[model samples]
Target: MKILPYHPSVLAQAQLVDLINYCQNTEAHLAIKMAEQADIFAIPQVYQQSGGNFWIAQDAQQIVGCIALLPLDAHTGVLKKFFTYPPYRGQPVRLGAQLFDQLLNFAQQHDFTRLVLDTPAAETRSHTFYEHHGFRRITPNELAVAYSYPDRHSWLYELQL
Candidate 1:
């Protein structure tokens, strides 16, 4: 699969709608306690800002997965809204790893050194994904305003590039 930054006009309306639906389906059922972390609307807004660049995995010209990066500062960025379509979901962890690699490459080229992200405690798979990618979990009582979600405890991860 070819992964590249998202361009507003490159993705169709149907795909954006699907992404919204996917966001709702994925985060909607979290317990109220977990809902806060799941309710990050700025995820889509990142697409609008295009500040840190969003990446999509395309095959045969079809978008099968995507991830977005939002810079918190010149040296740190939050990786958010990552998803691979159901039909394309499976072990090819390479897909995500590669996207991350690209993100880091971009960061380095731009003089950044830290990549950060938050994952809900309930998502074991995501935890594993980050661990496998060489990210370390941070233990802190308070979270950054952007990382804090109401219902769930957010797990913070940091990768040094």
Candidate 2:
């Protein structure tokens, strides 16, 4: 598999949409309200507006995973849209780790002092993953007040770089 930064082109955007919507509908079983506001379809624009970046992992030219780093301020960023296809989640595949490592590297290169993310409270696997990667759970109030997208039940995690 190969990891690449997202391009703001029709093909790239379409593939991103496909990967995210598939994950939300199948794996996440997210409520329609959550899925709709997840904003998977406007990735390029969202990243562009936030002065951030989106990345994708591909296997044989098929998008299998994705992650985004959105700038919340000069010293902080918010990790978003992190997902790996089911078949690639664990063991030898490890697509999620690869994507996460890349995002961390990018954050360091960009001089971000901290990285924050919100995940659904029930995604225990994801919580474990984040914790293993040096993220610590933080109260919702600890998150920047400007980040209002995540619901009240979402668990927040932060990594201090």
For this target, which candidate reaches the highest lDDT against the unseen true structure? 2
Instruction: Locate the minimum summed-lDDT window of 10 residues in model 1.
Output: 32-41
Report the C-alpha lDDT of model 1 over 1-161, residue by residue, as the tens digit. Answer: 78877665635434744654564466444433223433233444654364577777887777767776777776777776676665565565456666667777777887767777877777777889899888899765433435443336778788878
Across 50-110, the per-residue lDDT of candidate 2 in tens digits comes to: 7778888988978889999988888888998897878999999889999988988988988
TM-score for all predictions? 0.72, 0.89
Clash totals for all candidate models: 7, 0
lDDT, candidates in the order shown: 0.65, 0.82
**Judged by TM-score, which candidate is best?**
2
Over 4 Å off, model 1:
10-13, 23-51, 86-93, 141-151
The residue-level lDDT of candidate 1 at 39 comes to 27
Predict model 1's lDDT versus the native.
0.65
